[model samples]
Target chain A: MKLTILGCHSATPRINTHPTSQVLEIRNHIFLIDCGEGTQVQLRKNKVKFNRIKHIFISHLHGDHCFGLVGLISTFRLLTREADLHIYAPKGLKEVITMQMKLSDSWTNYKLIFHELTSRESELIFEDDKVEVYTIPLDHRIYTNGFLFKEKENERKLLLGNAEEAKINKAYFRKLKQGFDVINEEGELIKNDTVTKAGSAPKSYAFCSDTAYNESIVPIISNVDVLYHESTFLEKLSHLADKTKHATAKQAATIAKKANVKKLVLGHFSTRYDNITEFINEASEVFENVEVAEAGKTFEF
Target chain B: MKLTILGCHSATPRINTHPTSQVLEIRNHIFLIDCGEGTQVQLRKNKVKFNRIKHIFISHLHGDHCFGLVGLISTFRLLTREADLHIYAPKGLKEVITMQMKLSDSWTNYKLIFHELTSRESELIFEDDKVEVYTIPLDHRIYTNGFLFKEKENERKLLLGNAEEAKINKAYFRKLKQGFDVINEEGELIKNDTVTKAGSAPKSYAFCSDTAYNESIVPIISNVDVLYHESTFLEKLSHLADKTKHATAKQAATIAKKANVKKLVLGHFSTRYDNITEFINEASEVFENVEVAEAGKTFEF
Candidate 1:
């Protein structure tokens, strides 16, 4: 899995810095997260294929988080897209989007699907053979949900030399991969351990942003391979963190350390500070494996 | 009066070209017209005093025309603006804007007033001491209206020597500036024209964009000093213009000539075209005082 940072700044878009937006690629699926203004241009700069973005997820309705959505949809319509597009966002997104289209009399040729979200509890929002995604309830000023993508368990591989000589038939192979004992045509028991080996362990990624230092999320997203949490401030401004409902670098590191995530990625920095070294320095005090999330940077797991 | 083109391209924004937005300063009042994506950055690059913009007029709710509004508003809020903002747009815009603020849980500290348009007839919408703005109905695929800003008649200046010889009283000076017959303190009737000369001729500007080549706007915006019109295509693609409810460069110039406008400016060219010379060449065929609207370029009337 590869994740690309399209934009990570807080507040508003600038000539050099953009607001919150990113792209997560797992297996064959490309998911758009929190599209901000100038996102399409950022996507072009990052070399992301416009047609391949099938699903878009918005964390909240902040102008910085989802303002780019309507423009991107309009561009897709202008490009004559025919594929169905799915948007998973908080409730009221449909009304905001439809109003613009209504006044402009511009309709999309493609199927525009909106999956309005209102749940305050964790639930599966999307699932396929390769990955399963669930919403991570967040504590914020508004209704917000973070998404966690967990790779599903893979099928066991048959030990070719051992299985062929062990008289493992095609019918029994299915049971062997599932670690089940199968009786052959001769009515003899066949042990699964001798014919198949276990598959690779599934890896998961958790995305948390625009939230304060909340430890309640640790249980839901524990043991994630990679955790991307917002660090809008450093330890110096820890007092301001609570008032704004945002986390500092130290707080994010504490969450990553408590959740036992393998790697901690920090982003969504406030544009007040000119340098980013302070964030990594502060996060490294609690979490050993911490990295800064820079624009156009990619992380692989 | 000075008109500045913030952006002039159509469709998606590019690294070199912006989508659509402009700024017009009439007698020190700054007006933002059609805020497309990346407008704030454009404003910053052009060194525009964005805080001076007290009013914004949107033609329709097309994403390219209004996507930047929310972000700009948010930026103003972040900057702690305390002035009230006035927006004139079509109906449904209030819902769209308010929903974003509601979802984000962030509203402007200043008063946000909206004038929602739901009619097909032309009407006066804005007025101040020096200028008055009215809507000019246009034909389009959507409910679009062009704006006409006419400089109001100014107070006549007194000819000092003539006023003294006419025995005009200081109390009647105000009435004399209004072109009224003034009675002096000595009970002598003084013709206003004898003491005061006529003020400067009022200048006018008309903005027509994202519309078909409609002639109905001529009567509403008749005899404007300068007209800025959208020319999405050249004369070669006149058929495509008809199909898309847009005008070619020559067609825009034709409207300017028919309306007896003194000058014409063409913009909103499609990104598919490599050069903008075709629009100028086509528009210059009919209108002698024609200028191509380029980004960061300003025109004075």
Candidate 2:
């Protein structure tokens, strides 16, 4: 899986810095998350194929999070895109986007689907043969939801030489890869462990932002391969974080530590700071594997 | 009067090229016209003070014209702007903007006043003691209206030496500046022309965009100091211009010539062309004084 940080700054978009937005590639799907204003331009700058974004996930209704939705949708229509587009966002996004379309009288030629999410529980929102997506309800001033993408466990790998030496029939090869004992050509039981080995471990990623330092999400995102959490404030401004319902870098690191994520990616830095290296330095105090999410940067796992 | 081209390219916004948006500074008022996506960033890059933008004029409901409005409004709120903002746009913008604010639950603390226009005929939309703004209806895919900003004729300039030679009393100085003949202290009539010369010829700017080759606006914008018209295509693509309700460079120049404007500024060029100098060459064929509006370029009139 590959993740690209199209924008990671908070509150407002600047010349060099952008608001919150990212592209995630997993299971042959490109998912757009938190499309702030100028996201379409950022997508073009990052050389992301426009049509590959079939699914969009919005964390909240703040302008910094979802204001780019209408422009992207309009651009798609201008480009004459025919593929169906899906948006998973908090309730009321449909009303906002459709209203703009109605006012402009520019309806999309393709199917535009909206999957409004409002449940507070960690419910399964999307699933396919290779991956599953679940909602991580977050604590914020308004309705918000973070998404967790998990790759499904792969099929066990078959030891080709060992299977052939065991005189296993070709038809039983499938069963051996399924971690099940199968009958050999001599009608004798063939242990699956002797002919098969475990497959590579499944990977998972969780995205959380615009939320306060809450422990409720730790259980839901525990042991994920990578966790991207918002660090909108530094430790010096921790009080402001609490007042604004945002998390400090130290608080995000504490959450990552408690969740036991393999890697912690910090983002959503406030624009007040000229340098962002301090965010990583502060986060690393609690979480050993911590990195800052810079615009146009990509992480592969 | 000064005009700043924040973005002038046609169609969708790109990394270096932006959509339709500009700033007109007339009579100490900074008016934002046609705020396309990423306009706020452009404004910042141009070093335009955020507080000076008290009024915004949207040409139409097209995404390329007004998609950045919501984000600008939200940023104003985040910055705690206290001054009221006035928006003059085609009908239905208020509903579209208010709905987004309602959905996001991020209403602005300052008053957001909307003046929706629906009349096809030219009408005065804004006016003050120093300046007046009129809407010049244009032909387009939707209900679109271009704006005509005219600096009201200034008070006659005070010829201090001539006024003193005429023995005009201090109390009559105000009357002389108002272009009126006044009674001197000697009880003699002092001619206004002897006391004061005509003030700098009143300057006017006409913004016409996203319109077809319609001559109806020529009379409304006639004799203006500067006319900024959309030239979305060249002569070779004039057929596409007609189909898209846009104008070619030649057509824009023809309109400028017919209107008898002092200077013609061409903008809103389609992205298909890599060389913009050709547009200027094409337009110069019909009008002597023609220039292309480049992004981040400022024009003084």
Candidate 3:
């Protein structure tokens, strides 16, 4: 799995800083998250294929989180895209985008599917043979939700030499890979563990932003391989973070420690702080494994 | 009058190319025209003071022409702006903007006034003591209008030396600047022309963009000191220009030549051509005094 940070700055887009937007690539799916203003250009700067973004997940209705949706949809029309695009966002976002398109008289030629989310409980949103996605309800100034992406458990790997030594027929290889014991040509049952080995462990990721410090989400994202949490403020401004429904670096680190995530990624930084390294310094005081998200940076796991 | 081209490209915003947006500084006002996506960052890159822009003029509802407006307004709210912002755009734009702001629950502290336009004929949309802005109707795929910014006839210059020689009293100096024959202290009538000449000829500028080769606007923008016209295609792609309702360089120059504009500035370039100088070459074939608009380039007229 690879994750690219198109923009990590919060509040507003500045000359060198952009608002929140990221691209997560997992199991042949490229999911766009929180398309702030200037996201299209950020995607271009990051060399992300525009057509590859089939699904977009927005956290909330705040301008900083989802202002770029209309522009991206318009661009898709201009490019003559024919594939159906799916958007998973808060309930009100569909009206906002539809109004703009109606005003411009620019109805898209391709199908635009909107999955308006209104559930306040953690529930499964998408699932396929290889992956599953669930919503992590977050506490924010507005109705918001973070997404959890989890890879499905893989099938067991066949031990070819061991299977042959056991005199297992070639037709039984499929059952062996499925972790099942089968009768061989001599009508002798072989143990599944003797012919197959365990597969690699699956990976999971959770993204949470624009939310206050809430322990309720810790259980939903517990023990994920990677957790990206918003740290919009520093420890010194803990009061402001609480007042604004945002999390400070120390608070994010505390949540990471509570969830026992393998790695914690910090992002959605406020532009007031010039030194981003201070976030790492503060987060590391509680969580040993921490990383800061920067624009155009990529992390592979 | 100083005009800064924040972005001059057509279609989508790219890495190095931006969509249509510019700042026109005339007299004491800074007017934003056609705010495409990424315009707020472009304004920051151009060092334009956010507080000075009290008015924005949108040519049409096309995404490339006015998509950045909602984000800019949201940023203004974040900056705690208290000044009133006036927007002059097509009739449907107000609904589009209002819906987005409502969805985000971000009503600005400042007043947002919209002057929705549905006029098919040229009309005066804005005016003050120093400047008057009129709409120049154009032909495009949608309802679009160009803007004509005219510095109102300036107060006649006071020829101090000539006024003193004419024995005009200090109290009569104000009258002399208003182009009136004033009676001096010595009971002599001083001719206005003897003391003052025309004041800088009242510089005028017209911005015409996202329109086809329409001669209807020629009369409205005729004899303007500087004319910024859209040249979205070169001579080779004139057919496409007609189909898209955009103007080619040669076609734009034809309108400029017929209108008798002092200088013709070509902008809104199509990204297909690597060489923008070809626009100048094609336009120069029809008009002599032609300039090409480049992003971040400023023109003082």
Minimum summed lDDT over a 10-residue window in model 3 chain B is located at B96-105
What's the best-to-worst order under DockQ?
2, 3, 1
Please give, for every candidate in the order listed, the TM-score of chain B alone compared with the true chain B.
0.96, 0.98, 0.97
Kindly give the stretch of ten consecutive residues in candidate 3 chain A with the minimal lDDT sum: A96-105
- Model 2 lDDT at residue A1: 90
Q: Clashing residue pairs, candidate 2?
A: none
lDDT of each: 0.88, 0.93, 0.93
Question: Per-residue CA lDDT of candidate 1, range A68-164, in tens?
Answer: 9999999999989999999999999988888778867788999999999999998899998899889998887888888999999877878878777
Q: In model 3, how large is the Cα lDDT of residue B55?
A: 99
Work out the TM-score per prediction.
Answer: 0.90, 0.97, 0.98
Candidate 3: segments with Cα more than 4 A from true spot = A167-174, A185-187
Residue A163's C-alpha lDDT in candidate 1?
72
Better of 1 and 2 by DockQ: 2
Q: So what's the TM-score on candidate 1?
A: 0.90
Identify the superior model by TM-score, candidate 1 or candidate 2.
Answer: 2
Residue-level lDDT tens digits of model 3 in A6-50: 999998999888899999999999999899999999998998998
TM-score of chain B of 2: 0.98
Residue A143, model 1: Cα distance from true site in angstroms: 1.3
Residue A105 of model 1, lDDT score = 78
